[model samples]
Target: MSDPPKGPRVILEDDQPQIAPRLDFGWDQAVVPVVPPNPPSRWSGFGRAAAGVVVLGLGLGALEAANFTAAQFTRGAVQGWLTLGVVVAGFGLIASAGWAELRGLLSIRAVDRARAAFARGDLEAARSEALRWAGGMAEAAPLQPALRQVGSIAELRALLEAGPLAGLETQANALGRAAAVQAFAVTAISPSPGLDALVFAWRGVRLVRQVAALHGLRPGLAGTVALLRRTVFDAAAVAATDIAVDAAARALLSNKLLEQFAGEAAAGALAARRMLRLARVAAEACRITPPR
Candidate 1:
């Protein structure tokens, strides 16, 4: 039976063949990974000045540490000798490193509190910090930060042509006029309710305007993530319009019905609410995105 089975069997065309995948070593791939360049840091002028001051301080520190150590060595006492030999020599290095670290921290801390507030999205705090920072600069027809802060209709037109803020210097000068137009429109409309409500709306708008001015509907430069910023602005504009319209219409309609039946006073309150909503939209648009 074994002998008979030894006869060759025919291979079937439909049978699966033995196979192995060729492995890729990937030796031909480029050695270096491609990565885009990082964006430049955006510190304020005063912040940059402060940064420079810290750097200058480092130079002074080296000489300062040595001089201070030398003075300690010259005191000429057993205690002084130990202070120089043990405490001064080893401790001096420790103290020097510690001092430089502390200075860095203090330098940042001195101004950083306000900047931190700005980061937390407080325009008032940022504006105050900006103005205070500007006050320290030499008077030269007001820098951008200064113009941005006290930028009443007058200063915006005059000092805006050129100055330190020349980075933003462009036909965007039209932005200043746009903001002024919004301001003027408000002034002309004169939405008088009373002293209390008036103050709240005014302050709210001012805060809104400050935020808008700094963050316009426009994005930043190319590769600056400007497009992303503009996308955010577009989203905000669309969302804001949708919200404002809904709120305003509802408020107006609710007030009309409420006054007709329930209470007339309720109508005015709702109207004020609607007015503020519109004002926020107007303020944000005025400051950030000019009507295109």
Candidate 2:
């Protein structure tokens, strides 16, 4: 029966609206937290104490020998005083070196603090830190007037970036390019793996030091080592993700012409890539503020 009116047929599809699947590569995830080092064990503490005692004992023995030797000199009293003066001077030099290293480390820490302050929008703290950082750069002198006019953290960063930082970046780029070329050439032509390793190490150290110096850092041996450690860790973390990309590019570029020198070309390219990465890392580490 045509019951009342044939109710309009209702159609229902089985599929619901599908949301585009979002791919999370973990890029937006919080950085992996660093595990704090274990506290020093009792044995470690005892070892350190024993080493200090041994050092003191050796120093005392050396002093006694030096005193006896001076006593036998023709001008015993004058010689003793001279020896004392020499010893004092040596200590003075050592103290000066230590102080320099400490200053360098503090300078690096100041850059870190300034970066953090600016990031948190603490304009007052940022201004103080910016001024302190600028004070160390002779190139920043002419930019002082403009810097004084900066009323915001962003403005301060902009001024520095367009001014002294720009020049420093240019110099750093040149240094990095030179180092990369040297690495490529050495790796391609080096006869022994040992020599290649030595050259790479030497160039890396020199490049890092030059970049650090360009950024107004006077990192001494200890400071340089610390900076190197940080740079290597950072660069390694970044490069790990890039290795597949680099390999793909290398494969695409391998042609008949390159095939003739394939081994050398691959080694050279890899070396250059690593050196460039190191240079970039070192430059970033020594920068007063994060790049825009």
Candidate 3:
């Protein structure tokens, strides 16, 4: 009977029960397929063919015209030779401009590749990319000695940031600050919202171009458009809450001056914030080794 009554008595452990370890199913590690899910459309193929045909036709027509002009000149027509010379000179200029723009685009791509290499901690790749990028810019001449002495990716990056990149950053900051202040003033004083929009748009584009130039990127029309698109998208990705909080703080401070100016002040603050964000994004986009 005593043994039966004591049978229910049990000892409890002092330590807490252990939780089962989480099992990783590796869903996040799924690799993307090389082939797209959707097949190429026949319409796309047709469109490409049509474009090729149009380009070929244009080339043939230009060649035919050039030949005709040369033949006329051989037949003693001074006007034909003059026209051919003008045409040749015009083509030469166009070709030079196009080549410059292509070089600029290639420069941009090189910077992007260097940035990617740095992000991935590929030291050799990053070093080579950095050297190639710096070689193209005259402003990097002063850093050439230090660059040659770099033994590691970190050293190279530090040298760049302290030398040419530092100067570029300074210029970019000044540009951004000026743009922001101008945006604020314009938005606060302008009566027309349309005018405010236009001013902001112009300032944004100009600021981006200036920042890019500071980083040794002389983007032409196409490059400018590309940089503008990238900067805008990057700026849009910035935390909205952070911008709102900053704007609110500024608004609160400005409210102390005059309640009458509250609405205009808030609008101006928002515009200024946007301009600043764009400037920063543009700088980052143009940097050889963008911030991690």
Candidate no. 3 TM-score: 0.70
lDDT of 3 by residue, 192-269 (tens): 999999999888889988898887788877788888777766676664755676567666766556655665676788
Clashes by residue pair, model 3 = none
TM-score of 2: 0.73
Q: Best candidate per lDDT, number?
A: 2
lDDT of 1 at 83: 47
For all candidates in order, the CA lDDT equals 0.45, 0.80, 0.79
* Native RMSD of candidate 2 (Å): 12.4
- Lowest summed lDDT across 10 adjacent residues in model 3 is found at 1-10
1-292 per-residue lDDT for model 2 (tens digits)? 5568666887665584566456688964556455699997666888899988977876885687577657745567677777777766776786798799998888778878988887767887877887777787898767766767789888888888888988888888888889999998998788998999899899999999999989888888878898898798877775675677656655876686765466567668777887778878898888767755
> In model 3, how large is the Cα lDDT of residue 25?
83
Model 2: lowest-lDDT 10 consecutive positions: 12-21
Task: Give the poorly placed runs of model 3, Cα more than 4 Å off.
Answer: 1-75, 238-260
Residue 203 lDDT in candidate 3: 87
Compute the lDDT for candidate 3.
Answer: 0.79
